[model samples]
Target: MTLNLPQLRAFLAVVDAGGFSAAAAELGMSQSAVSHAVASLERELAAPLLIRAHPVRTTALGERVLPHARMALSAVRSVEQIAADATGTMTGTVRLAATPTVCQGLVPGLLRHWREDQPRITVRVFEGDSGEVAAWLEDGTADAAVLIDPPPAAARAFPHADPGIQLATDEYRALLPRDHPLADEPGVDLRDLEDDPLLISPNGCEDRVRTLHRRAGLRFAPTHRVRDLATLIRMVQAGIGVTVLSEVSRSLIPADLVLLPLKPQTSRRLVLTGPQTRPWHPALRTLAESAAGHLAPTTARPAEGRPLPSGTR
Candidate 1:
């Protein structure tokens, strides 16, 4: 006896979609063709696999065979993914997740580069907090994710193809209104803000901010709790309260706000994370390399009177 993948797929699709017509639409096949495929599958197995009802259901034997069929299909797809990786062809959709800051600061450049390099590949991005990003990856909702200050155990749990590909290490900076008394000063310590009414965004960075405060033996009781990044910046612009954010986030600050480096020099590393066990797509690997390039240090230029390095351009 011979088992056909198409027939099995058709059977599964019908069961999944709950009707032959819906499965036909999903598979881009005529209803008659899908019905025929299921019929052929039944003939091969010499038993009825599905009950032809409004919402189709599997028979006892079909339920017994379903697991093996799904496994076979998954194995076949894995083999195909391996082949695609070996050939270095960037095709298919890549589901990606990242925090709003990274999406605003870095992903646009990566998208532009990807468009020019591999137009065949489509990227779908989802914005979420670091914890949500991890949830997306664990639930298979995203092929990969960009995380800020990911816990050490998470790295061990979901190791990527390029484990140490650091996208960026952004230093935390103090955002103060230009009219503030200490705005003109170079830097300020976290302890100095104890008396001031602080404004902190309740987005993904809340935990990180709390941790930083906790380390300083302080607590964060924001005078105003802001949820949106843009709104928070506008509030700071209006001199509502001071806030702290990463260096990359400075781009969002208006001219009236001054960005000062934190006195203690706190920073967080953003890393690209991928599935630990699944075979990663070549496009994802390529993306990882591109992301790492963003943080690659540039060579210092030679002084006008000094000798140039051999490979200096």
Candidate 2:
């Protein structure tokens, strides 16, 4: 039997949100509208796709059918991207999850490039921590995600394509005032900064923040805590204390601070996560390469020294 796309999308939403009411909120429709759509789907399918209970599930019929339903939806979305791509236009929403810096600095360029190339495509970027990114991927919200840390093994994993999952790692640097004693050395070892109040970002800042310290066999004395890179940079400019952060996008670092590499060296793991079986889209593949350029050293040019790629404003 044929089913309408709205009803199928609603059915998927109901399954994802766990109940009709929650699904209604997610869909931005009245409860009655959600109920009506689901009822219509059930009537047409002649099978109950959801069990009406807390932590709902697919009825025996649903368990057998839901998989196919999701595949069908994924296929439909894929076909849409293909058609758009063939026309030299990117269409459909590619929901992306990323840390704030990558979202702020890199994605804009990617989106700009996508728009110039595929004017019809809509890209939605969500910013959050690694945990939030993973959650978005598993629950059918985000089409893709970037993380400064490795995704939990159980989460639906969509590995980064360019460098193959483990993106390039940078030494945990101790940013010191220009004239500080440590600034003269080519690099400062973590052990040398034994008493410095190690500035740390909030737990949600990004997974890379304190990971270097973990590898350096030390714990941070977080006397100063900030939420984003800008603030962390400002704190360093003020000489409040030293901080360790991702130097992946070197251009984004402030000009006022001196970024030095750690003697022992530390690396942060970067990964891209998505549903394991989600049908691949060429746009996504392009995005992965573009993302790597933004994160890894090879593709990125020096700050303000290099112009945006061809076709990007």
- Using TM-score, give the best candidate's number: 1
Model 1 clash pairs are none
lDDT of 1 by residue, 164-244 (tens): 345667888888889988888889888887877789878766767787788888876879888778888888888778888
| Worst lDDT 10-window in candidate 1 | 303-312
Expressed as tens digits, the lDDT of each residue in 1-313 for candidate 2 is: 6688778778877887788888887678988888788889888878787888897777888767666777777888767766765676555556788777667655677678767665555677888866787677655567777665543443334332222233334345667767667878888887787687667777643245455556667775578888767887777778778776655545667666677877566555445544554554435554544554555464333212223222222
**Candidate 2 residue runs with Cα over 4 Å from true position:** 10-39, 42-69, 81-90, 149-171, 177-179, 183-186, 202-220, 249-252, 269-273, 289-313
Q: Model 2: which residue pairs collide?
A: 158-274
lDDT at position 165, candidate 1: 49
Question: What local lDDT score does residue 44 receive in model 1, on the 0 to 100 scale?
Answer: 95
Candidate models: Cα lDDT each: 0.72, 0.64
